[model samples]
Target: MTQAVTVRRDGDTFQARLFWWHAARLLDPGSPIIRVGFENGPKSFDDIWVEYDPKRSAQDQYGAPLRREHVQCKWHVSPDTYGYSHLIDPEFINANTRSLLQRARDAQLAYAPDGIGVRFKLLTNWRLDRADPLRQMIGTRSGAIRLERLYGSATDNSKAGAVRKAWRDHLGLDEEELRVLARTLAFGEATDTLDGLRDNLDVLFAYVGLRRIPRNESAFPYDDVVFQWMAQDRLEFDRKSFPAICDRDGLLGQGEGRRHVYGVKSFEHPIDRLEERCHQVLDLIPAFDERYIRSEADWGDALYPALRAFLLSAARDQSKLRLALDAHATLAFAAGSVLNIKSGRHVELEQRTTGERIWAADDFPPDVNWASLEAEVVELDPQRPDLAIAVSLTHDIAPDVRRYLSATVPTVGRLLMLTPSTGPGAQSVACGRHAFELAEAATRMVREARGSSPVAAVHLFVAAPNGFTFFLGQRQPVLGPVRLYEFDFEGGRDRSYTPSLTLPISTRTGDPV
Candidate 1:
């Protein structure tokens, strides 16, 4: 729950914005939501209402009856001085209870249609500070001491309880009636402040379009995409405008396909296909830091054009790079592309064994190729027998576990154990380069045994960074389906290993297959 940070408190635009945010989630595609009235308009009820049908006009005499709702938006900021006594402050009581009752009454009389349902909703950004004794008095417990005192069952009342009395007098309701009204009042509270909300909005934004580099607050210099959308008028809190955007984008429920799938469930491999249909959004951090963030007045101008160009370039390469490869192919592609990007020219790719041409110097290359250029090609077996490649880039496996795997899994086929080369006095660290190297070595082994026999299977026993795992996926169109394993380490020692999900390797990526 985030209070909208982009607006001011005095003007109370946040209430409207809050309404906009909620309405977007509620309204169905093409549901008729009419702006019944604004603040202080005569013959109007609260904020807005949804008509039973959009096909029939509200003005039509024989049209369908309008099914509507009453929504009241309220914004409350905590008092500067903290005290239990502030809970009874006339201002707080007046804003929340008395005024709300009057509004609800007026709206009911003006708009409640016969035999049609009406929902009363109160949306607010209040904590209802628990320090207030008044809040405690409204506890859900039926036999509570606080409820008894408020209802006069317990008869000791001072000036502190007068706020409840005022509310009762204004609404002309008894204790039980007030309790029922309280239950009917749909209260939505935002516990999170604006800043925290903004951070979450960033993650949500990633699903829609952009991908940003992961970094600490100090390292992240640009304004967030949500804030930018707010500033540019792309995001609004109006009754008609908000729903229209949701309908256009198909964010109706769990979202339309990729907007919800890859964006929401990136952890799970796709069930129906090898990959998602969505394009990989450009990583904007590098360009923003290099060209705009610190440069005062010209930042926007510089950023906009640079972003446009980068997006265009990515779009150009998308079709060619859409194909997914196994660790081997991903390595060669990455090695060649990384070298090409660094040199500002294409790199020649050659087969290790025959020195046969693979990619010419002018050929377009993928990003992970830099490490592949320097990697050695290892032959698996001359007879080209079945093989199992166990890639461990993170750390050394326990001797006992290794021996078990050797005996349990058939050794008639070669077992190529791939690990990062450790340097003197330096602890082994897994990274993109190391991941690519392992894949490159595995690629050579696979190539040598291609026609002789099936790959048997490639099993990954990995303890690596998320970035490394992600890159490993990027390089896949492996010779066969790859299986990932999870190892449990208990008491700082290896305990057991369990098979995880199988990787969905796409051969040529047009759609997710």
Candidate 2:
């Protein structure tokens, strides 16, 4: 009995953490989730409830908008695996009177009679049985059973058909009724451990401007707070009330003024919940799909004009802009130039390579060790008017830049290579301050190298973090007319560097300077 009590307590903590995760998103004005509830929905799947605004509802794998999600969290002290057969077992689902399938059907009927916009989810720490036929039917990306697989092929003699027959017989339903229930049901494996859930919550807490759990602290204040709330029967929260509760609990962090998020996506997997996080989104995937530009004209005609217009409008709002870039390095630099240092906008870059960190110019003190640059100059043609600058902080891209310049741009007379003193690698740049100092040093190097010569334009190529590239662009005015270049990382388009946006965009005419 004592062991059972302890097990229940641990399980409650896990459920509380999951509740806090969805609940905290209510602080974001742009979040689609308008309300979150704990232990307040259908009794069987009532661990948590997340209600989305119908106008901005999140879509499922099949692209159907979801209005609400009823989640049931099952946590265990030891590793366990379950298969299709176990789902119908009363002991496995812990059903007193009705099985999980029956509860899910009832919940759908109550919430969404037509089954247009509701989901019943079972989130468990237990793994799916590796050898089970159920594993083959589940969609790897969706975590939901495939509709065709659930219905099975024509004969109904396949393994998936057998599992479907078992479930249908257990539920006492016809094929159509079974399809409706299965469509609304999703079974997902929770990958996070107890501590891992806390870590994820810390990230969300920071984003919503809430106090984070202090490092190395033995006591978990968040878990304690959830327990307190549970005792008081304060289980429901919405956009307005959630922040009030957080403040009353002393969970609010130092207030930063109005934050406006912007997303620049050029990839297939866009930023998740971008509409929830950003006030505006600039999608460049149409012009530059994945890694390669579809056409040479697309950069100047479509991508740059759209990006510049977006930044110009955002800067006029006079709010701190938080930029999340899932784009190529060149476009990242171009974005920086649009919202240049003179724009007087406090911009924060979301850096996510090693781990998630918000990098801002003033986040840390200047590191003197990171102030200097290792410079190498190569004179290709002294008579030519153009000079190429290769900044390699992430990796050595000088070789690739040189090859591209030699084959394509004969007008580029010289090439300048700039790297960190410690040499180039992923961890070369430490933080935002370090990146800012490096950008300053790089700008000064370009000025000294040009030295009263008739340098027509500076061709810029950078292999660095998106944050660093933005910082570099902020300092572009110090260098003369600068042209940015993008490389085909995916090798779909010639496997070479192509010129992108030319910086120092004219303010009066909105043209390249």
Candidate 3:
């Protein structure tokens, strides 16, 4: 499985956090801090010296991005229970809550009653990338606030040695006792005592195997990715988020398959509100709202059972639908997509060499105007074809066979092209003698679609290497292959062109280059 570590952004780089999975394994739920402990997860969870180091961002070449090797992490939750700052620092406090909610949702979403025992589970993973650096950082980082967050008062035995001794002396009774001691370690006005003990397997976690969480990127905020991965096979990931309590609709699955999510709250609330939040969390996925995936009436019957369960609960002050869309994994070796479309083959293009046989459209020049639309319908009164308006298109070809056809394609046709996000955004080397002619073609497509045509709107599409910047003239036009397409909104017409070369994209998204 591809390793992933959960992280929250601290200024520029992400600060590692302890998530639900670690808390479930390390903390006992019955402890006094359970509500706050699980609710805060790592955000408020204090840090003891974890044996992990951060990977800094840097750069070498001039003007190249520089990855900083280190930055003082100021976000560690304060160890002072009395520290008035955490309650005051809105950002930190909200972050603490958000982190907890994310994990809680993860736990609940992944819950399996048939499992052997009951325990909160954080369904995530990480990697060995920081293995070496973590060890080295730990060596020089001794005596630093072990738990970055607040813990019990340090004993005089020595800040480092004392904390260890305190646990060693009173706690380490047995495997079971270890769990209790871990939970009870929290300090508050009232204190709880540890009791049970079990086998302490003959082993050592000399390395706590604790690393700060990693910050993963998302495309459509949250919900968009859900559907993109679920309804649409556009993007794939190893794991994704889900919520614990799902309403009847079961939309949280991202339409891909069953997913797990967690639900968290500091205080009790009503069920409808909870259900609303559940939908709200789901709203964060792919299409924003359920309606985006399916029509309301179409999904009405399917969602009835789930809605009834929630409505009844609400009537009795019992309806509670946890908005628990936790992350899930759709991870696997999905095929690589075509990035750019230049006139060339794939194998030799990886290294960006001219060795691959690349030919422009001119190399296989056709005297005939490929822009003819005699077979295509334009004006439509109900799938009626739009006017097959003729346009004066002209272009010169390059020695490499590059040719730009400047003819205006009728908007009332289907425009087939690869998604721009999937490939490089490119423009053909051609000029329109009269740009208005091309604009008129677009107008016609829209008009036909409006005239009772089945097609609703004319879609204008374009492909760009990096996403388009509107200020920089980047358009949202459906980014597809190398070609740009403008078509009638209502008319079902076709306007496709030959592809050129392809570009390379990193497994990680949002890369500019």
Candidate 4:
């Protein structure tokens, strides 16, 4: 008799959870995913398969008109790392068998014979070795290989060249053949824990009309259903059949309309399911370090222009938008400016305070006495041309602002500290309406201060909720020549304020004021 196999339940469960994450998208008619499969694809990298509709702007991988992503999930209890040289090791390829590279090539020929539209992803909890040349060859945003790095000059003798040559020789392929394979391969770090994946699923469930797993309940309804399907050898889901399965499993709910979620990521921490949940994603992270802008011109040349273009295009179809911002205070404000009150669009901001809440200006009735700003003006050098305004709604940021100004910008002659009348704390702004009202009052106060002095420019430093910051940005036009600043929350550099975007972009030339 054959020995019974001991299954790694942790790995199995992780794969199953990942399957549901992609499979649930079928419930949304607007989603680009047309089909999802469990344990049913090419043998090499086939934990799951997701086919996307080519018509939609789907999948970060660009070349293919019709895209199908093949994913292999490798989950381990302990963290580990791999480097470029490990690709030919026994870990990736057994001695007498086809290597991972070979299998990828075979899968490409079988699915996309023309060498286009196919992506193979190795999704693991493992990290890439920081010291390896492979780290530099990978695109941070897309998870795809950086082709330019892989295809260096003919006389190249760098470590990257060695990696490329090794991979090519191991695969028994020519330069052109290696390039084709490189384009199709992606290595991605799985950032979610099992609990985190569940939380993410709950959010997706709410959006796609599935019954959410109760917080207090111990039962894993989605997991149980997936296991039962696996036992029954039911491995595939398409747009038509997935709904029937949902109905049979008593998982159906009143579905929401196609949500147009946009993610503006300008920081290190990533938003969960940003690419999957968002209709459009503005990846502005490349222009920033933890504390400062990489290049000052990035605001005008890259960040603002990209944001403006995306919002303008999205506004053409969507009357209402949902924004997920993992960004700086300055960009958050700039986003609000693009979709200002005059734009005739309703925007709901994903506000992650004590918990997640969708905040919109029209969600509640405005109260005249909800919140008020108490302003204090301090005199600096009278000869200086700039005035600094520190708006501390969440906490008192005046000390930090003062320190930053003293050490850096000597051009500021005055400092204006604005705090909520109720004193600075998290609940300073009562609701969305209160935030709008407070923003308006804050803008009015700035105009008054500017009028009293011959200040050439107003420097703004804000410590508040994203919704409030956005609302403040919407009112930017009336406040002349305003420069926004961002705090180094991550403490990557000196924990201080750094200048970011300047408002009132020139209309004709499309440049920052």
Candidate lDDT values, in order: 0.37, 0.78, 0.21, 0.78
Worst 10 residues of 3 by lDDT: 195-204
Q: Is 1 or 3 the stronger prediction by lDDT?
A: 1
The global Cα lDDT (0 to 1) of model 4 is: 0.78
Estimate the TM-score for candidate 1. Answer: 0.31
Q: For all candidates, what are the clash counts? A: 12, 0, 115, 0
Cα displacement (Å) at residue 322, model 3: 16
Best-performing candidate as measured by TM-score: 4
User: Could you estimate the TM-score for every candidate?
Assistant: 0.31, 0.64, 0.18, 0.72
TM-score of 4: 0.72
Task: Write down the RMSD of candidate 3 (Cα, Å).
Answer: 26.2
Roughly what TM-score does model 2 have, to 2 decimal places?
0.64
Candidate 2, 372-442: lDDT as tens digits:
68888899999999999999998899999999998999899989999988889888988887887788889
- What 10-residue stretch in candidate 1 is worst by lDDT? 264-273
Top-down TM-score ranking: 4, 2, 1, 3
Total residue pair clashes for candidate 1: 12
* Number of the top lDDT candidate: 2
Candidate 3 on 229-331: residue-level lDDT in tens?
3344322111111121111223232221111111211111110111111211111122112112133332223232222233233223322111221211000
